[model samples]
Target: MFDELRKALKDWYKVHHRDLPWRHTNHPYAIWLSEIILQQTRVDQGLPYYNRFIERFPSINDLANASEQEVLNLWQGLGYYSRGRNLHATAKCIVDNYQGKFPSTYKELIQLKGIGPYTAAAIASFAYNLPHAVVDGNVYRVLSRYFGIELAINSSEGERLFKTLAQDLLDEAQPALHNQAIMEFGALQCKPVSPNCSLCPVVATCVALREDKIAQLPHKVKKIKTKQRFFVYHLVRNAKNQLAFTKRKPKDIWEGLFEFPLLEFKSEAEQITFLKDKVQVGAAYKHILTHQKITAYFIIDNFPAAADTEVIYLDLADLEYHPIPRLIDKFLNAHRHQIFSVGQ
Candidate 1:
């Protein structure tokens, strides 16, 4: 049974696999970079970033030696900036501890910072051809619908069951090809929406097809409630024509990325009251994340001197070099008139 299923899937893959840049490489560093970038990111969007990153930092040592701001700048538009941070940190770890070589086995790969189970499995199989099943969203969808799994995927038991089933179906002789085939089959063929069930090779064996449970088979325990956040950014410029910026602390969405000095308020009234000095407020900007929705308002200010705080100020001409969030980039582009209207 396993051989039949594997043959069907691998045969489909051999003819239908997308010519992605990551798929052509057996280099562990390149594969690891691609996996990290693709998390919470689409392949179309992540592919260019992958190309740019590898081109700039071809080797792990190059990534480790580069500044965090350089990495974040390259990853500015990509929402999940933490991946960039971790990519750099892990590269440094490899260079410092592992002599710039990615861990060769599943156990060692999983032990590295920011390398989760899915990533570990992918690298292990693709780079080393180790017999570990990749259990990403694509795999979950494919296995759940084909196997008629009714357990909530968010639950531990469900995860265990699906992972076990995925492992059971893995073709150990061709783990790399098998892993790629399963993930691609799910992404292109058995998609979340209306899939091309007419061309499905395993439709006869797929329980969800016979029972019309494709949408319901991969059950989730709960729907996530995105947290709301309000941000007040003070875009300060001094007589020297330098704009101030600060680093986001850990545990935040844009952790280790640069942004203007920010203050959080529970409400608009509270934010207005907290403003010791009246400043020109720009239109509100909204930047949505997977688990958080950010409403950011910019306050434009000017002075003859600096605030004497820890804020690092850069010339307006040099703003392009510093890494800022997409929200800030949008705000700056929309209100460039205010910035250029004044001079030192």
Candidate 2:
């Protein structure tokens, strides 16, 4: 069953796979860049970012030498800012420790900061043709549905089971092709929602389709608990036409990014009470993270408080030079006329 499934997937991939830039090269750096950029990001969205990064940085050494802010700026629209930071850090580490060459083996690749087991396996197989199975979300879904496995993917037992099954099904002689085929198959054909099962090469043998459990397979034991956060941003413009902005500190969201002076409230009531008297600058912005739902409001401070050392005043024109969260960007864009009118 595994052998036939493998052949069917590889055959399907040969005729139907999308022609992505990363697939054209076996260079570890390019492959690694694509994988990282595509994490939690769609192929269409991440493609431009991958191209921009490759064009701007060109090499691992070039990326290593670039500033963290520069990396973050390029990565502004793409959430999960930590991945940007880690990408920069890992580039530097590679240059300093590995002499700008990517570690060839999975063991060495996994030791890098941002490279997890899935990423390491992807790099190993896709770049070096090493026989390491890639077991990501796509793989888990495909495997669970194909084999009718009932184990929760997030559980340790399920992880081991899936990993072993994936490895067993892998075509050792053509690991790169097999890995790419299975992942692409999962992404394009056997999708999480409304899979193209009718056209799938292994549709005849798919257990999920046979048992009507396509949506129920690949079960997760844990559900993410989302936290509600409320923020009030003070858009204080001084007499010099400069707005007060501060860099976010570490161990928090948007760390190292710049934004207006912020005050966080524990509840919506507290946030509403504080903003009741103040005039809102723009429509309230709601930004959703993996584990947090943040609703933020921006208000103009006519008589601003004494400036703190951490707060830096920047001309409206200079705001582009600083990295800010998308929520702040949305506010600025929405109320550009009002902000500029006040400044003038």
TM-score per candidate, chains pooled: 0.65, 0.65
Candidate 1 pairs with clashing backbones: none
- How much is 63 displaced in model 2, in angstroms? 0.8
- Name the TM-score of candidate 2: 0.65
- Summarize candidate 2's per-residue lDDT along 1-344 as a digit string, tens digits: 98899899899999999999999999999999999999999999999999999999999999999999999999989999999999999999999999999999999999998899999999999999999999988899999999999999988999999999999999999999999999999998888999998888888899999999999988988877999999998888777878888898889999999998888899999999999878677777899998999999888764344464388899878977999998888888788678757532
Off by over 4 Å in 2: 224-344
- Lowest summed lDDT across 10 adjacent residues in model 2 is found at 300-309
Q: Which segments of model 1 are wrong by more than 4 Å?
A: 223-344
**Clashes, model 2:** 0
Task: Give the alpha carbon lDDT tens digit for every residue of 1-344 in model 1.
Answer: 67778999999999999999999999999999999999999999999999999999999999999999999999989897888899889999999999887889999999988899999999999999999999988889988888788998889999899899999999999999999999999899989898778899987898899999987867898879988888888778766866788877788788777788887888767876766565655667788999888888777653323355357888756777777788888887788678646432
lDDT of each: 0.86, 0.91
